[model samples]
Target: MKIIFNRLYADYLMPSRLGEYEAILRQARDLGYAQLAVRDFYRSRDRSPPGRVLVHRHDIDSDLRTARKLFALESRHGVRATYYFRLCTLDIGFMREIEAAGSEASYHYEEVATFAKQWRIRTPDTLRARFPEIRQQFARNFDSIAERLGCPLATVASHGDFANRKLNVINHELLNDTALRQQCGIECEAYDDALLRHIDIYISDRKHPVYYRPASPFDALGRDRAILFLTHPVQWETNWIDNTRCNARRIIEELAWRTSASC
Candidate 1:
């Protein structure tokens, strides 16, 4: 007996697989995009090269194995990317390996949301009341991750949690206070106005193509400008068949988590 995949499902599966991702990268390269890691983008402010540039960024939500595979592929193509990792998904070995492979590493933070939820903060006023605790927790987590990596983490990206509506706090808000930036010794948050000024477009593949709709500005890369491409490892697979299965499992798992959290 033979099993057939629906055309719509097959189309949805293309973007998240390894082959499609590689094709995208090759297209960008052919279009004269000089890929830069996040840290490099930060460094090249006034002296940015006169051409199109792609800032490749990866938020490693989970699944270290896939992340490593992506890293290897990028390495082979002579490309470097910045990877932001969550504290909950810390993998020192993989982190070191990726860093060794010429990728930059930074923390993917959601401390504000996590703190607000844990303390049952329901209003912005209440969130402000617990700012001290939140700041301290952020410092501790950052320090611990930095220490483990044996490197000074100069940048961070907020792990946006759209479901938590009560607190109205975002991780990037913690960097609003100059004192917080000084205290944590962090130079830049990925979403900061200063940093965003350099980026002409931002695209992300948070969920697979079918679920998460992204404004794919990269499709029209005719202008000589900076583009930030954010990707997650779990979304990409070796093939569409595997990608479809992975996306299905991820959707179910996310739904279950959200349902339990709501309860």
Candidate 2:
């Protein structure tokens, strides 16, 4: 019953979210908020002038086409945002286009958590036992992706893989070790402590009706606030039919996760 309701909500109620996404971006621009990507915001967190700032980030979990559209829209509105791509969405051409738009393209990492799921490291002690191997893969993949992008990624956002819930581990947990961060050339994680400390408000479009759960971005405009926004391109739809298909896929994936995790 809940699954059916969720599918209806995603496929029907949220089809106009893409427009809402643009509306907020445009509103911020008009209100004199300086929009910056994740990398730039983090690098200059201390020296930011006293004003309204919006730090926008997009995680491309699926639907590269939608992500590209979102990128172009942001570029049109003179908004710079960081785009984090999973392994499937990392296209050199699109990433270069994003760079051309003056936005940051980085990695959305899930390798370590996947390793845990594959090895069935269901407990903290077992996960720690295989930490070496898992960490090695994380670094290797990060390096490999950086080499492919032809530049160092300033921040990597950990992916919340369904496998993570079954394994009792988070992908970014490995970033706790400062040494690992240095070895991988990661300047910061998406949820860095410093970022959380500095930002006055954090908003994410990962959930339903994101603009209003706590409050709307419009309400925060004109105030001196540091706002961090995380959006998944797949969640907002340009086509109703396509969005229905996407929602169906997610529903299937959710059911599969629930079933597999139970075993």
Candidate 3:
């Protein structure tokens, strides 16, 4: 089977990093990654994806000015991407611009219960006791966001919810939940694919490359088709300098050791 590389991405851009992001996008385009998946960028509202981490805030602003700048850059490239909107932080003018520029948009939601837990506002045990109700509320909130976006959303990805978690968080459940899938009209299933192993793919923790995960987006009934990639836009702006150096060192050390053993 020929392995095809695809990138599904999201980015939470901090206000200060707009210029850096421009450079990163330029590099991706030069390297042939013309398209990307995104959650929130420069939208500094709370519950938004934190810089270099999955943490959320109660009052982060949605850096709209910066977002507009990036949007303009994408326009010049003649490339389109999926931008998941946090319904609670929806800015009508911004949403209109996204549509005007021909970019695909969707919803970005965090299960309220999960958000509380992630922030240590509630313990996991407490969340488990109330998961059913929590999931319903979460889905409903997402539905509301979709309504404002106007079209039956084309695709969806989590805001601060990472797909690689071990538990049935909202994003994880949405990967295969028929009900949620039908509600959101999300075509691509979001799961922890093997290629996500390069830790450098994340901005917050560039000292390590992503370790591979075994789950496939498709069920056991596998097919040969295009593999979808998801990456964070703000995460891409972070550097992976240490990880790259470590990898190079390991490679050279392994080669030398192998030669010595042979002699």
Q: If scored against the real structure, what TM-score would every candidate get?
A: 0.80, 0.86, 0.51
Question: TM-score-based ranking, best first?
Answer: 2, 1, 3
Q: Write the per-residue lDDT of candidate 1 for residues 60-120, one digit (tens) a residue.
A: 8666667877887888788889999988678877778767877788899988877755654
Clashing pairs in 1: none
Residue 129 in candidate 2, Cα distance off native in Å: 2.1
By descending lDDT, how would the candidates be arranged? 2, 1, 3
- Going through the candidates in order, what is the number of backbone clashes in each? 0, 0, 33
- Per lDDT, the best of the predicted structures is 2
Which lDDT tens digits does candidate 3 get at residues 11-56? Answer: 2121244455455455545544424333222122233332232211
Write one digit per residue (lDDT tens) for candidate 2, span 1-263: 87667656765675656777888888888888889998888888888544888999899877787887888789888889999998867897888778777889998988766665565444666776777787888888889888887878889899887667756677888788888888877887988887778888887764453434355667766664788877887667644665666567667766654555421
Query: Which runs in model 2 stand beyond 4 Å of their true positions?
Result: 11-13, 209-212, 238-263
Query: What is the TM-score (0 to 1) of candidate 1?
Result: 0.80
List candidate 1 segments past 4 Å from native.
1-16, 206-214, 238-263
Which scores greater on lDDT, model 1 or model 3? 1
lDDT of 1: 0.74
